[model samples]
Structures are given as C-alpha cells and as structure tokens.
Target chain A: MNEIRIFSPATVANVSCGFDVMGFCLDSVGDEMVIRKVERKGIHITRIEGFDLPYEAEKNVSGVSALAMYDAIDVDFGFEIEIYKKIKPGSGIGSSAASAVGSVFGMNELLGRPFNKTQLTEFAIKGEALASKCEHADNLAPAMFGGFALVKSVSPLVILEIPSPEDLYATIIHPQIEIKTAESRALLPKEVALQDATTQWANFGSLIHGLHTGDFEVIKNALHDVIVEPHRSKLIPYFNEVTKAAINAGALGSGISGSGPSIFSLSKGIENAINVKDAIEKVYAKTGIDFDIHVSKINSKGIKIIN
Target chain B: MNEIRIFSPATVANVSCGFDVMGFCLDSVGDEMVIRKVERKGIHITRIEGFDLPYEAEKNVSGVSALAMYDAIDVDFGFEIEIYKKIKPGSGIGSSAASAVGSVFGMNELLGRPFNKTQLTEFAIKGEALASKCEHADNLAPAMFGGFALVKSVSPLVILEIPSPEDLYATIIHPQIEIKTAESRALLPKEVALQDATTQWANFGSLIHGLHTGDFEVIKNALHDVIVEPHRSKLIPYFNEVTKAAINAGALGSGISGSGPSIFSLSKGIENAINVKDAIEKVYAKTGIDFDIHVSKINSKGIKIIN
Candidate 1:
C-alpha cells in the first residue's frame, strides 16, 4: 500500500483541425513511473531511464507535477519517483506529457486517490508548463481521461471527453528526427485569414459530428488542417507524400502528429490501418531514414496502474 | 403530384461560436411556397407576397432555385412558384433562406423527390447566392435538413446534420431594425488574431460536443462569441442588455442570431424558454423599439408539406 506504479500513454495533440485544444491517447507507447514513500519531506527523483532527462526534482516534468500535488495536499507526505520513459523526447507525440501525467496519477493512487481526475489533470498541466513554458491541457487531458478530448479553456479547466467510434484506427509514424516544440510553435503565424479560420471551424465541427455519428466519410473530409499543418509540416521530411500515400491506401484521414517528425493517419478498420502503415512506409523507405510505425485504435483507457 | 405546398422554417445561423457554418431551424416562424406544373418550358415566379421581391425568374430566389433544379434534372419541366413570406426580410432570421430552401424543397417534392436533401441544399445555396452574392448553406442546410446542421464546405457541398437533445428549446427575439448582411459582414476584420481563432475553435468544438452529449453546462460555457458578436452586436438595439437578461433568467445561452437585428437564446426546458423570452422582452420594452419574440423547440422536422 505504500508503493505503486503507473503507466501514462503517449498522446497526439492538435488532431489536425483543433489546434491547442484537441488530442487523444495511444494505447501502446508511454512512460512508466513508480512512486514510494520516502523519509524526506520533499519529492525526490531516485532514478531515470530510457532518456537522459534531468534528475533534479525541480527541473523534471514528473518532479514539477509531484510538487504541484504537494501544493494541493495539506499533509507532509514525501515520495521518490522513478521514471521509465518509452516515448522518446522531442518525438512530438507527448513525451513530456506521459511523464507529467504519470507522476500525478501515480502519486494520487499512492495517496489513496485524494484528488479526482480533474485535479490530477491540473497538476499534470502544471508539470507540462515547466517543459513548454505555457500552460496547456491538450495532451494531458486525453492522457488522463482517454478517448478524444477537447480542452475548452485552461483557466476554469474545462476538458470535454468526446466519444469515438470503435472502428477508429490511428497509424502513427515517428521519424528519427528531432524538432523542438518551441521552434515548431514559433513558426506559426500571429494572425490567420478570416476565411481560413471559418474553414477550420467547419472542419472541426464536422469532425466532432463524425466522431459522434460513427461516420467515416465525414471524418475523412473533416481531418484537414488549414492553418497549422501548412506551416508546421515544413519541419518534417516528405510530409506531403506520406500523407497522400496514407490517404491513397484507404486512410480516413492523415496529419502530422503533435509538432513534427511524427505523422499519423486514421482509418476505419484494422486492415485499412495496416495498409496505410505500409503505404506510408513504402514512401519513407525511399528516404533511408530511421522511422517507427504504430497502428492503434482509439485508446478509451488512458493511464493505468501497472503494480 | 403536379402541385406541392411546403413551408421552410426560419433559422439562426452562426450559432455564437460557429460563424458561417452552424445553424438550426425554428418551428413557428417561416415562409410558405406553392409549386405547380405549367405547360411553359421554363420556371416562373407567378406571385410573391409580403415582400417586394423581384418577379423576374432570374432575379427571384425561388425562381433561381427552381431554375437550378431544372438544370440539375436536365429535363424541360415547367413550374410556377408562388411564395408567401411570413418571415420578415432583413430581420437576420434567414428570410431569404426560407424562400430559397422552400423553392428547392417544394420543387423536389413536386418532381417526385429526384434530388436528395444534399442536392436540394446545393440548389438552395445557388438561390441564396443571388441575394448574398456568396454561396452559403448555414441557413439553407438547417431549413432543408432540420435540427442543427454544420456546413463543412460549399465547394463540393458538404453539409452534415447533427442530432440534438429532444428537450432543447430555442427562444428567438427579432427587433424590427435593418442591418444589411453585406454591411455587417464588411465590418468583420479580414484577418483575426491567431489567439482569438484558437479560442473560437475551442468554443466551437465544445459546442458540438455539448450538442451531441446534451450537456447544458458545456453549451453554456461554449456559447460565447469572441470574434463576430463583439462587432456585430453593436448594430442591434439593447443587444447586451437582452442577452444578459436572457441568461440571468435561466436561459442556457444567448447571442445575436446571424448578422444582427435579431437575438436568440437556448434553454433546456419550455418553462425556461418562456422565462427567457419574458426577460428579454422586459429589456426590449424599455427601448421603445418594435420587436417580435418567438419561443420554439429545435425544429426536428424542417421543410414540411402543407398540402
């Protein structure tokens, strides 16, 4: 009862049409953290694995989130968190989010669930802010709540979990290339055309409708990114050809995952999802670049207690 | 059936966060049109009532829509459309859309339903283009398909009908003032700040999620308009007071419908709808301005045959 371990799933943010607001979790790749009561009064990082992340409690995502949990609780409890990261850093698939969400989720469980999901999400976002320098819940919301989530606002912390069809499949490809989130975000335009904004909202609306109705064609049409993708896709290699190949191979929709270097496509069925993965790989095979492909369905279950 | 009669309902477009894409219909206030077969090989507007619209076939919305049906069918079918307008023109309640949707819907019914709802919507947008000088389906789509609708695109004509909770109520207030759609649209900035655009999409996404999930609090939070309402609401009399009054009186959400001169609020139940109407009326009573109020539920049945 004094020690617990949890796993937080990797997440894809933005989701093409909903920039800075929408995201969903992946079932497979993630980060694992083990929390145990320690003699010290403050949070401590005992060990880090899979990546050369900062071991300082104040500098790490999990440590910052643990600090937030301490600020929320009145008891003078202390813990040492050991993180095993499976998601690579700068992968644009919510690597930092997994650590942040895992810490808060694990700590809450270790303390016998003192806070609800919403409070845990708030703490996770505080941890995310330490990494991104801005507070956002697009990744943490889904990583905590699962399925598809829309973060309406960060102030009052309104996060809505949207229902997704059972057949929804996500095919993700992460190229072994690093694109810093700050550099990618800094490339965005300060202002966008009114017409493009209108189009983006329409797409976002249709995507929501399609998710509710389980209509694949509507999702296909709604998965276009008119604003962010046009600018951010430049950071990735063969972004256009890979997306086109996925679409040609029966993907319901395709787009860049999170920030860059990783691309994802959605399909209606497993066969189409595999076909899309192969089609994308066929294009990526030509570049001789190191890459990874993951075909997953919508992750309805987010973070889980492993031990 | 050589003769057909149909009524096209009034609609509230924009729907707060979704400008130019979202809309829903009203039940009681609308326009009626009667279509009958004729020996002449061309469409004609035989008689128009309640508005000083053009009698020429190419100039009238009904005539133009009937012409579009003729073009789509590729047959020399002659028809005469008589429009009885009950919805006031320039009231910002989709008056022109009523005529346009009524024409295409009645023509389709008289022609034995050759075109489906999507096709009929296409023809209706052509009719709307004659008046607004732009092809928009926000009003026409809901008037043709009923309930709430999201017009994804006008190019390939993607319109999706969204389901609504059965108890959802629409309370509308139309002030007898004229703010031309052209002038109102011209007031909008050609480019909007990226921050504002992101906020708008988040609201829009939440609104769609709320509508599908039937969560009133989500809808209440999502109904805020940051881009268009701030500028267009200035054109209407007592816009702020009316909206505040409606919300204060238990309405779920309130905002200016479409361009201006009319405001609408959504309530969860019939009693709340009535209370919202009364609260809005009490505010408008001080303005000494002529205005009409209509309380209705979501028009699940859109254009209907009268005979």
Candidate 2:
C-alpha cells in the first residue's frame, strides 16, 4: 500500500442549539494527519505534528481510530499515522475531531474504502469520545462533509447539507488560552430554570432556520445561548467585550463557540467579518491574550490531502 | 369608496417554537367580507352568511372591527358589512382572527385606504385581545400578508415576511366538536419543565428551518409539541389516532390546528395531503360526527380581494 498525506479541517460543534447535532468545518484551520500502510497487522502513529498528549493506542485519538477501523475489517497490513496540529486543543474549534477524522479518512484510502462515510464517522466518534467523555456527532459531521452540515439524527448518522449562503463568513478568533471540555462542562448547571431552557430551544430553532435559509437576521436574533454561554462566560477573560465588539463591528451574531475560550463570531460578508475579527482581537489584545483570526467560508471540502 | 370586497384566508398560528410570535396564512378556506359606504354617518349591519353568528354591531366580529377602524380613522360615510364564514369558529383555526382582519381590511377600503395594511394590523391586534384576552400576532401577520410571515415584535408591530417553500401541503381536519379557547388554554401550565421546554424550542428551531428550506423531513422530525400538545391532547377525542394516522399517512408533521377539535397536518405533495385528510377523517366519521377537511398549500399569498 502507498502512503497518503491527508488534512482534516477543524470544526465548530454545537453551533448554538445544535448541541450534539450541528457543526461546520473550517476551510484552512485544522489538523493534518498522514498515514502509511505497513506489511504486518498493527497500528503505529509517529508524532509528526500536534502535541503528543497521550500515546497509548486506546488513549491516542489518531491511533485508536485507525486501529479500530483496521481491526474490524479484513486488513492484514498495519498503518503508521502522523498529524499536523494547526488548531490547538480546547479552542472550541473541534481540534480533537480533526485528529480522529483525519486518522480514519487517511486510513480508508489505504484499505480500499471498505467502510462508508458513516462507518468512518463511527470510528471518529469512538476516538473523540475518549477525550470529551460524551459520544456526540456535532464535531464529526463537519469534518466528514465540510461546509454547514447538520447531524439531524446521530443514531444512523444522517447528514443534511444545508446550502451555504452566498455571504456567509465565519470570523473565528481563538484567544490564546485553554478551556478544556471537562471544566467547561463542569461550570454548567445540572438543571436550569424552565424559562431559560425554553429560551435556549427558541434560539436553537431560530439558528437552524437561519443556517438553512441563510437568513442572517434570524441568526442574529437567535444567537442567544441562555444555558451554556451564560454559565461558562466567566471562564473567558473578556467574553462580553469580544462578543459585543464583534456585534458592533457588523457581525450578524457572536457567541462562545463550543466550550469557548476561543470565541467565534459569524458575520455577513468578508468586510464585516474582518471588522469583527479586528474589533474582537483588539479587546483580547488588551487582556494580554494572544489570538489568531481566521476569515473563511464554510469548508465544503472536508478531508483532503493538503500537502 | 364605491364598494369593498375582501377575503382573508385561514391561518396556522403558534407554528412550533413561535408559540405566540409566529404564524402563516393558508391558501384554502377563510372568510369573505364585503362592505359598502352608505349615505348615513353611522355603520349598519346588512347580512351574514355561511355560519350562524350574531349580527349586532357591538357583539358581532365584523361590526366590532369595522367600528374600531372607523373610530380610529375619520370616515365621513357609514357602511354595511357582509360576512361569509368559511372557517368554523373554535376550530383552533384563525376563526375570530379572520373576522377581525376582514373587518379591519374591509373598513380601510370603505374609508378609501386611510390606513395601510400595517396600520390596520394594530386594529386587528386589538381584536385579538378582545377575543383571546391575549395580544398575539401569529394570526395577524398571515391574515394581512397572505403568506408566511413573522411577527417580529408586537408592541411596535414588526411583521417580517419569510419565504414560503413551494413544495408544501397543509391538511386541516376539524373534528365535529368544540373545545372553548378558554378551556383549552386553561389546560396549559404556566410553568413547564426545563428539559421539556428546551426540547420544544429545539423542535421549533428545526421547524422554522424546515419552513424556510422546504425540508419536509426536518419538519416531520421537529414537529413534537411537548409543551402544548401533550397537555392539550386530552381535550380532543381520538386526538392520538388523528395525529398518528396523519403521520402514518405520509404527513410531514401533525399538530393541533389551533387549540384543538381541529388537527393540522403537513405533507410533501398533493397526493400525500389527500391521503392524510382521508386517514384522519375516517377516524372522526366513526364517532358519528362529520368533520371538515381542508387540503392546501402554504399560502404565499395572504389576503386578496376578488369581485
């Protein structure tokens, strides 16, 4: 078998009410993992890029995903995986998902595509679950299909590819800090008030409609997160300032992007998106937090060989 | 004005998450109202058709709405009103709203368009408070606009027109019975469980997206009305059968039309719509009470005047 160089774009999961159900892949921002087949049956992953957080096959996302796929199928050969981690962990940008998706997708080519995208999605889910402690599909769908896709129901793994609006621009500002999924989940209330719960769903419904129709105004109106954002906002140093600045700079809506420390804002066009990034970065800069801004459209192309 | 003839269509209010803020007009059955300026300075009631209703200027809907508009805007001439009721009252259909909108619309024409449709919407809102004791805009937007519209904010009255998907069919079946609005509304709890409310909103958000994108599958999946339907289902006889039957008959989704005694269902095409109607009506027929079935497309056109 031949060696393949593959890149899986980072994703934003739980795009407001989408919770484990919605996500979109970023075009240029993500992790790149490369895999090569060997003669014997086993999995080997060398750290080419990305932080070497854990190395055990069960503990490492990239290795575990490839190992699971190969073990389940009739693969007599082994594979070595390498990753280029451009998106930092805990960026609320689905860095973990990119690694797992990259592993499965890169290995599929070496195996002659024995499994469909859903089967590959399962492999990714199992791998990512080791870190997040929850089996959710929000992160996997975006990495699989790219662009703005909805994991309508994850039981059978259904993907709804919503037509990305012409002017849809994602202005993601990753504040240089870490807010792990565990701590972010810990800050939330076990039970929320009924009214707040209703508000969340209303926002969720509005966001879904907004994403589907590309109705920027509706998305703006519905960009509220009563449950998670309010509770988790304090975890970020300048959460309110960044969100307000982005909105003031013509962003359609801004929120804590999935267990955020790295806040993301969705804007209408490139100009507004840039303005949002500049404004948000200014506030974070004052806080002495280094940040990176990515201005891109919905990555309609999910996993690919970038190098 | 020489003469005024106006027809307002039936409307589905509280469309999913829009419980009170959203509604859309139906293309099929509604109410027809006609008014002519008389020489006298005071309004007079001439005739009523299609259903048994009151004729007094103070007690009747047409008389009350026409009187309100006349008082709000200066009218030098008196007028005679005629109403042909098509949508039965207390069917959870916009029965009272149709009359109110028609009166407001008909009078504006009789007075030579002193008030625009937007201005007349306020008068219609007044009628809503008069009937339901709650000021809701779900019915008013559709009644005035002719198609799918949203009541953005009621105090200032912002009615945003949302695009209606072309491939949609609404099947309305009015069971032969009555559930008074007060009684049905009474069944609802002011405070709901947090989890249930969240589910409702999520469903609602998806429903809105479905409406904008013309995705019937999303609409079907997101149609569970946990807040209103579950509690209110006990009021109508064989409610579960009707809903289950409509869904089983290929309906995109089904919910109580207004409050109940009427069930509203959606399908992708005309054939499925007819099937849903037949399936639901077959159950009501066995109870020895005939029901009215309305098969229609989403009314992109709200109110119309044909002489």
Top candidate on lDDT is 1
TM-scores, all models, native as reference: 0.98, 0.88
Best by TM-score: 1
- The clash count of every prediction, one per candidate, is 0, 5
| lDDT (Cα, tens digit) per residue for candidate 2, span B1-307 | 5678888888987664556656778888888888787878766778888888888877776677677777876657788888888888788779888988887787776556778787888888776666777877678778888676666557667566766578788898887787877888778776666556645655665666676777777778877777777788899888898888998999877877767777788788899999999898888888877778889888887777778
Candidate 2 residue A183 Cα shift, in angstroms, is 4.1
Tell me the DockQ of each model, to 2 decimals: 0.92, 0.35
Instruction: Rate residue A212 of model 2 by lDDT.
Output: 67
Runs in model 1 deviating more than 4 A are B74-77
In candidate 1, list every pair of residues with a backbone clash: none
Candidate 2 regions off by >4 Å?
A17-20, A112-116, A186-215, B15-18, B38-80, B108-120, B150-167, B189-202, B209-215
Interface RMSD of each: 0.6, 3.5
Residue-by-residue lDDT tens digits, candidate 2, A121-209: 88888888876887777788788888866665656666666566777788888878877677887786766665456556556655665
lDDT tens per residue, model 1, B1-307: 8898888899999999999999999998999889888788888898898988999989988788878878877656588889899998888889889998888888788777888999998888888999888999999989998999999999999888887889999899999888977789878988999899999999998898898888889988999889888888888878889989999999988988888688999999999999999998899898899989999989988999996
